[model samples]
Target: MATGLHAPILDWYAENARDLPWRRPDAGPWAILVSEIMLQQTPVVRVLPVWDEWMRRWPTPAALAAEPPGEAVRHWGRLGYPRRALNLHACARAITAEHGGRVPSSYESLRALPGVGDYTAAAVASFAFGGSHAVLDTNVRRVLARAVRGEEYPPKATTTAERKLAESLLPPLDAPRWAVAVMELGALVCTARAPRCADCPVAAACAWRLAGRPAYQGPERRGQTYAGTDRQCRGRLLAVLREAHGAVPKAALDVVWDDAVQRERALDGLVADGLAEALPDDAYRLPA
Candidate 1:
């Protein structure tokens, strides 16, 4: 079954994979690493322009490391999760100081980098260095759930069984290609909301399809709410700092969000998270 799964998915991927810049042969490990980090909880379309600009400005870890952490947050430009900018800055510094300005090829080394986790380490190792490791992102997990496990959806968090299943299906040769192929298949075809099973390469062999495409029976999936939340308030306050030439007056932040209590909490949270600096004279700025 694994062999059968491999050929069709690989063939489909060869014909249908998106021609993303990070996937190009000339794209280095740094580019791939940046793309992976930027892509967390952010869609591909939104990431493209920001990624292009970042690569043009800081082509290597050393280039980014030379700049202040504030520059990273400033350039982050509404990617939604501003903390990732700080994390990436720290990662670049660590890589430049420790790894000779190169992205580590091994999973262990990549995992040790700031903000990198098991999934990220495995993904970087496989996608960037051709190492054979299970790369279980949300897309890959969804694909495996329907195709192999006959389930509409996997668990909310990755489980031991899911990891074992993903590891078991890894191909002997070109495992990286296989891992990405499955991921693409999930992203483009077997989507979460409306899976195009008819267009799926493994439709005939898909257990969920064979079982009549049952609806997800797990816990209710909740959509993220952003508006009127602390997160939105933080983004608004951060925008003020990002655009300012120097420290922004507290009044500048106050005008962005109405509720004084929520606004103050958001600002305080940003300072606590190292995303902003509170000045002595009631001013704020991106970390210096």
Candidate 2:
């Protein structure tokens, strides 16, 4: 049976959804796929302009596939996780070569594409094609945890129980909208911290709200810290490459971080990850 909270949340989403370009009626499956990939671990505010630029430059999988992989990384800019850029490039190539330039609609086909994981495949299928999939992102998980399970927060990772709950709560007729609506409810109303309970349409039915919103007692959830980490060093190195139109000298990358050993390790890791290439001239450049 559909959860009772489905109607209110779906209605709330219809009235309160963001005016994102990718959400427009005209957005193609490829566009939806691109948006999903860009949104992984990145916020919508940062992804907007990049997505717009990508749409303008490479509107189709064939167009993006024709370009060198390095160009994709170059255009990825400071959105972070340049590896995703490479994966998108690979996906485009696969789509163009194998799928005849169209974003494959089937969950199996989408998941087969490079960088497209189960969540992403499900998201694209649901959002772009109106498939009846249970989109279990972090926000949706939290919403379900609080509103249904009466938990303060979901576990660190998605569990089989959560997936089953999501499937059970999924509405049959309006599955796509329901999936997105649940995600929106989690993103806007049932946020991680300082949720706007009064504005939430399903607040009255929320298990956590009914339970007096007890503090989470299960485990400590630590926020990711970026400062002084190898990831920071990597971001610093990638920034230099992203800014350069061509291969940058070793000296250019050296200035971004004070620790030469960590910086070198980060750069080497990037090369290994296929985000950057080590040139014969001993300089670094984004992969081609």
Candidate 3:
């Protein structure tokens, strides 16, 4: 009688999982990994076309690793978080050099790679390697919090207790699909702002909904401000560099932002993060 939430969620997912490209039976592990990274904080609609282009250009980790990081940055058009592009490029290189161009199978080896954080590591391990680990992305956390723990929302970050609770609910057999099922539920049904509770598979057992589905009475989750922030300045600077095939003049970048202090700080941050390199003549370009 699958007392907790994982069983019914997995069953529901089998019947209702979205036909996402990355979830296809023949999709390679590298492709799945790329999808996971791109899907971070990015919408599915935006990711689909970019993902297709990315896979066509760089079919394998070795393919991406062999190319200059500049190409990756150029390909990451309008993704907002450009650093994720740099990290992903570095991750490909690490996979090529260390894992013989194959995405690693074990959680330890996958987690050891550059930019392969907890969520990514778990995702790859479960989806690619068929491990029974619970891949707790934001969506999975929210669904579990509401359906099982009776919380209106999950925490700001993944907690140890959350992982334990999720793992405890993971059926020992075919656990990878179970993880995907819960995540799919969150994505398609149990959405962030307005969950389709009427169609939720486990609504009959949902603790939060049974408790009258009270609105999130606590202080609302603060949205991150993007306009006029340093992140915007960084975006401006990167746009100039990405457009240039070779090193770009410092004066050319200076035109993008007016504030000398903020612009310089953003550039410095880019250089510090290894996404950009200061050339011999104070020009800047994506790292070779």
The per-model lDDT (C-alpha) reads 0.92, 0.90, 0.86
- Which digits, one per residue and each the tens of the lDDT, describe model 1 over residues 208-245? 99999998899998888888999999989999899996
Residue-wise lDDT of candidate 3 within 25-59, one digit each (tens)?
88989998898888888989998988899999999
Between candidates 1 and 3, the one scoring higher on TM-score is: 1
TM-score of predicted model 1? 0.98
Predicted structure 2: clash tally = 0
Clashes of 3: 0
Q: Pick the candidate with the highest TM-score.
A: 1
- Residue 87, candidate 3: C-alpha displacement in angstroms: 1.7
TM-score of each: 0.98, 0.97, 0.94
Give per-residue CA lDDT, model 2, range 1-288, as digits (tens).
436887798789989999899889999999999999999988899999999999999999999999989899999998988889999999999999898888999888998998998799999988898888888898889998998889989999999999999999877697988888888888888888999999999888888999999999888889789899999999988888888988899999988899988988998899999988899878988887
TM accuracy, model 2: 0.97
> Distance from true position, residue 203, model 2, in Å?
0.9
